[model samples]
Target: MTTAGLSWFTVDAVGAAAPPDTGPLLLDLGDFGSDRTELVGAKAANLARASYAGLPVLPGFVVTTHAAARVRRGEQLPEQALRTRWKQLSGNGTRALIVRSSSVAEDSATSSMAGRFDSVLDVRGWDGFLDAVRQVVGSADAVGSDAPIAVLVQPMSTAQLGGVLFGLDPLTGDRRRLFASVVAGLPEEIVSGAATGTSVVLSRGLGRALETVGPQVPGLTAGLRYRLAALARRTRSVFGSPQDMEWLVDADGVLRLLQSRPVTAAAVPPRHSRPLGTAPIAETFPDALSTLERDLWQRPLDEGIRAALELSGAASRAVLSRPLVHSFGGRLAVDLAAIGAAPGPRRSWLDLIDPRTGLRKLRAAWRIGRLRTAYPMLVEDLVDQVDEQ
Candidate 1:
């Protein structure tokens, strides 16, 4: 039973539905051409747009907000629609998928809403997929925004490296340059800001960018970095504005564009205040310190930072608390008001940090002369640390 005025795009296995029009609910990522912000939300719409543009996006389906709107009104989803899509994914059920929130409010020109929603990753099987979708949809309702929530399901990228890219540098606001933060595995860790990643800036020409701060992304070749920069340049050109995007570089070195949003640039902050460990002493440290966590004043600064990371369940808390770290010039996240009081650093991680410059950075963070007194709230932990010595 197909309806007039709307051509439904359904995949293999799941057939058509009943007399009562449930509306064309599901859309394949590739089939999206016109803007469907009302249905798929901003992030999904952009992904769909890119997919339709012949970019190398993961094969996926968009669960339109129409289903969500029905759920909102206490109405039932068209069972036929759900089952067909389920078979498309779960029939053979070999590939694990990712279920991410796609909210209307996300990725607007005004707000990136980067970590505000929920995403269930590495989901396998039909039951798991359904649960993940419900979880994401429930997350949207709990979030309570004017925008309805939709879900995007795609095969998870086992990318050897992943993270974020800014079509233009947020620090210098240079359209000719591109900025990126890269992680060894999934982009989630870096994007959510719990851990920093290797930082790269591709300049004009071959995109000659400085390491500026943070450890450089490992295994990410110069050729790949240049390609990513070139992709960002194309994205900006297509959108007619600067774009900040999430990306994945699979083990095969295939690149995938996850999401892109508009960005505005601003003046660079103080080196100590910057996210990358760029202070003079940091020059000799390993790349991990700058990318993931920079140490505080304590011995075994890595231990302290890890203690800090352990406190949070995942990236959400890290993203909120990392007043000390700043993602490069993509997001206008310059001010970090609470990093002064965050807990300990990780072990094995702090050894690389330079003691002198690190002290200076800590002194700046604590806003005090005596380094011992800086962590007043953490005084008890400090005492134990000293006793360990």
Candidate 2:
């Protein structure tokens, strides 16, 4: 059985690294890639490639599958080798470490052995470290001898919050949506089915909140939402597939990539399946438009909205790069979700009390201030030109 609440895709060589010839007893996480999965295992290989591609990954080393295979055959662990690496990782002998399993069969495109092995967290001292390694290696017995397991050890992150992000909505298989679930402190509770996390769903293109569940978390800021959306998009671009990513936000608000794999099973909708609405737009047109009218007006309206989205910084260029207005049964409907057009600021005075939305509200206010400044100047120019004409 796969682990609960976590699913991810295997790597597809966005940046192929030649297998490091470094002896396989232990190696840096950056030393493996898709080409070295046999030696390092899928999880370690993915991390190495991601770090190489400039993603924010914690520095660490892997006790390679070669060593794990030997241990599985009832051989002793390379304790001296582990101690040397632990010194290098700990630096001060006080830093706690997290040990995770990276099985050769885990995170595979065909069969994601999601959390099928074991992980140890917040380990301290040599004795604890050795026990943690043994625990991780022993957990591999669940999958038997077929899948050799490598052990990954890294300095534990002092995370303020942690969760998982799906590059696409796993439930709906909607590629245009990003789904995330976050909880306070380490994400082990949420990943292990001990806690129900605050869930957030966003339009992938615009990073606009489509839905949010659970109480408003104090640090779940809109900027974080945008960043998560961008992270999902970038992972897909980097790995050539939609990914299930485990991430953490440290005390400093910096997001770090912890793990990533593909969504082995998901239902992807067709391009035309995007939900369309005619609420405010219907009020203006009210009925199906003639071909001549659609031909005459669609492009201009699309351009106007595109320009407005650009000016507001509410959406990215990629979101606004395409024509958003579409004809359905000769009636024009816009993908407001894609365009990120909302019914103006839905804010109450109570919003001032929440720190989470402060940056977003400030940005909105600043944009409004600029518009206020520019409108008068434009009107003055218009009046002057009218008199001259």
Task: Say which candidate scores most in lDDT.
Answer: 2
Task: Quote the lDDT for 272 in model 2.
Answer: 38
Residue 265, model 1, lDDT: 27
TM-score list, all predictions = 0.62, 0.62
Per-residue alpha-carbon lDDT of candidate 1 for residues 135-184, written as tens digits (9 for 90 to 100): 88887677777678888888877888888888766664555667888888
Off by over 4 Å in 2: 1-23, 32-35, 143-145, 266-389
What C-alpha lDDT do the candidate models reach, one value each?
A: 0.66, 0.77
lDDT of 1: 0.66
TM-score of 1: 0.62
Off by over 4 Å in 1: 1-23, 32-34, 264-389
